[model samples]
Target: MISRLSRELSPHLTYHSLYHTRDDVLPAAARLGRASGLNEDEYLALTTAALFHDTGFIDTYEDHEAGSIAIARAALPDFDYSPAQIDRIADLIAATRMPQRPADPLQELLCDADLDLLGRDDFMRLNRALLKEVRHYSHRPVPDDTWMRDQLRFIEEHRFFSPAARTLRAAGESHNRALMRAALASTNGANHAAGGLA
Candidate 1:
């Protein structure tokens, strides 16, 4: 079932988002397994939700959470997942939507995994790569300073829900902020030089 979903979903999604998230998702879910409240079925639901959480990015970048929900609904029929499990998975995937304020621990785990990179070690580099992905697909060239500012705004606005992610990934968040300020300064310096030379 996992293989079938991976095969169908991989083709449409860009590699960058998948590459980083795939490495972290299962491990994060495994860690979440250690938590007390989640039972076995709930664990499976969380794992399934984590796996397909980003699948919506395959068909479209904007509102891929809905896209992921649609993908899971379509693909799960063959797997014969119980209706309750299906609903759980769908809810978990949808929990990753922006403006997400998860009400329960399970939803929080999936949300943290989905936005896990916000706390990643290579955040600055990854941020550049994400900007590049957008540029490639949307044909919108984001200047370094502009990209940095956007990333800074996003970092300020968002945070990881899990304690592990927050504790481990905080450096990346701070580093990205510093990188953004530098980029803004550099862009302004270049503009000032151009005007002075003219």
Candidate 2:
């Protein structure tokens, strides 16, 4: 699945590339799950959710979580997952959508995995890559201040749900949040100086 995604997915996916999914998110999920003390079955379900969470992006740019669920339904049975297991995976995938609402420990782990970069060291570099990705798909450039403000809002509003995720990520996320807040403040100040706030 990941191999096909690496080859067939849009090249414009600067941040959502195979490296993002295969290399980063998958391992991140594993680490978080272990920290969360998930049993073998729960880990399998969560890992599978991580695997297929972004599969919808192959078909559509927005609202890919729904598409990911459809793809999972069709594919999971072949892999010997039961109906209940597939449903759980779908729930976890969908939980990664904006306004992320994870109902269970596993779902919480998946959410943390999805936003692992928010707490990671390379947040700015990857954020810029995501901006490049947006430009590639939309053919429009996001203004620097607007991007910084939006990133600040998102980082400020989001939180890691599980204890393990919070333990693993809170410090890094706080550091990034402070950086984003500083950047946003500077941008706002520059805008006011230019009288753009008017």
Per-candidate local distance difference test: 0.72, 0.89
Whole-model lDDT, model 1: 0.72
Residue pairs with backbone overlap in model 2: none
The sequence of per-residue lDDT tens digits that candidate 1 reaches over residues 22-49 is 6767667656555535688888888888
lDDT of 2 by residue, 52-111 (tens): 998888999889899889999999999999999998898899899988888888888999
- Per-model clash counts, in order, read 0, 0
lDDT of candidate 2? 0.89
Worst 10 residues of 2 by lDDT: 1-10
Itemize residue pairs with steric clashes in candidate 1.
none
Q: What is the lDDT of residue 143 in candidate 1?
A: 76
